[model samples]
Target: MKYRIGRVLISEGQLREKVKELGAQIREDYKGEKVIFVCVLKGAVIFFADLLREMGPEVDAQFDFLAISSYGASTVSSGIVKIQEDLSTDIHGENVIIVEDILDTGLSLSYISKLLRERAPKSLEICVLLDKEERRTQPVNVKYTGFKIPDEFVIGYGLDYAGHFRHLPSVHIAEPAE
Candidate 1:
């Protein structure tokens, strides 16, 4: 069960350092306030877990999961976003942060953000591990971003190709076999 991984774009050490830095920044930004971290599930689970741990005891954070899909099992998005799962907890009046693995095309995040905004949270923000700015179709305001990558087919560090290659510690562009 081996997958062909392309050149490593971001190393494991880099991700660790960035996550810590982002966590510290998040703590400072939301100081004295409790934040409900809404993780975009499946892909973001790994990054979300690591980020929460990095936030340490100084930050007051709760968590929920929202599963939205635009990409099925393929490397490219279908351009249509669908909510596979919804939040379990009520976020009304709570400071909400949407945690996502990658911001590609911005369709899913944009749709999710709009949906969450309707819930009337005290504040709403977005935190993403990776941002593919070049492929963005919609303008999404991401508050905290770990990395801004070019438009590439990437996998690992929680990103995946058809549900595979997520266990890799580093991020790499996926070079499909001919």
Candidate 2:
């Protein structure tokens, strides 16, 4: 399969600034307490890395990675989520934040949230880099969103298609091959 960049939807500078802003907000929201940042792996790795860096020293942040898959080498979601990996540390009685790459159908987040809630976390919230509300089949309350984008197949900045385009610094719409 071949793909082209349709257009740059979010520039690197924009992502940087927004991440910093979100980090500041998170720090303020969870001040004087240790917060566990649960990064949804693979896609969210880039966003999670950059976001944590901007969080500064005041926020007592711990980190873990969870790998869940709803889309596998495809542009569309299968509407089913599978947990490929789970958190290493217990989140019980801790302020937990799930950091995701995108919130599309909300199926994955919904599943993850429900599963995590059962663990008795003191608090649980979601932070996504992108939200495609148009494609949402299930409702998800995102505490922090970097961008609200159209229902387009986006790739780059840790988003990918068939395991490609994850290295692009900016987010772009993936154009189908002619």
Candidate 3:
């Protein structure tokens, strides 16, 4: 498929390597604790799938999904987030790791963190596949970060441009059409 861009920013191999690192870190930090991995939906589906596969032989974790929205069909955030789907299971007494494709404005992640915290999870954390710190208008921290990227519009490995290029094995910014 056409990438709509000339080159890849983060190749599939690069992302996979980071995921392996993330999994190993989690295994070390959590050690004996069990974690419920909450994957943000749509954009995170690919990342979540790949990440879980790499979490190691003995990492014990459950999985859930919460679909959130801010950009809708647009490629840019509007500084607001709405939950199109909420978690079906209670996070109370469970350790939670929130997994996401990219942490942009930090609004959606921050909002989800608060919402999940209200459930009184034993411990809550965030793991991001990509972080664009410059674009952040709100302060947000991620426990596991795959890459720190320039504040550019990226698509692939679950990131998208009006729902395009997600199947690409890497990340690329579409050249603005003339």
Which candidate number maximizes TM-score?
2
Could you give candidate 3's per-residue lDDT for residues 1-178 as a string of tens digits? Answer: 2336646888888988888899889888887767899999899899999888876657777899999889977768877889999999899999899999999888899899999999999999999999999888778768899999998888989888777778888888766764
Clashes of 3: 0
CA lDDT, candidate 3, residue 166: 81
Model 2 lDDT on a 0 to 1 scale: 0.93
In the order shown, what is each candidate's alpha-carbon RMSD?
A: 1.8, 0.9, 2.2
Model 2, span 49-136: residue lDDT tens: 9999876778889999999888998789998899999999999999999999999999999999999999999999999999999999
What lDDT is reached at residue 118 by model 1?
Answer: 96
lDDT of 1 by residue, 76-171 (tens): 889998899999999999999999999999989989999999999999999999999999999999999999999988999888888889999999
lDDT of 1 at 109: 90
> All models: lDDT?
0.91, 0.93, 0.86
Stretches of candidate 1 exceeding 4 Å from the true structure:
1-3
Off by over 4 Å in 3: 1-3
- TM-score of predicted structure 3: 0.94
User: Using Cα atoms with residue i matched to residue i, what is each candidate's TM-score against the true structure?
Assistant: 0.96, 0.97, 0.94
Sort all candidates by TM-score, best to worst: 2, 1, 3
TM-score of predicted structure 1: 0.96
Task: Quote the positional error of residue 60 for candidate 3 in Å.
Answer: 1.5
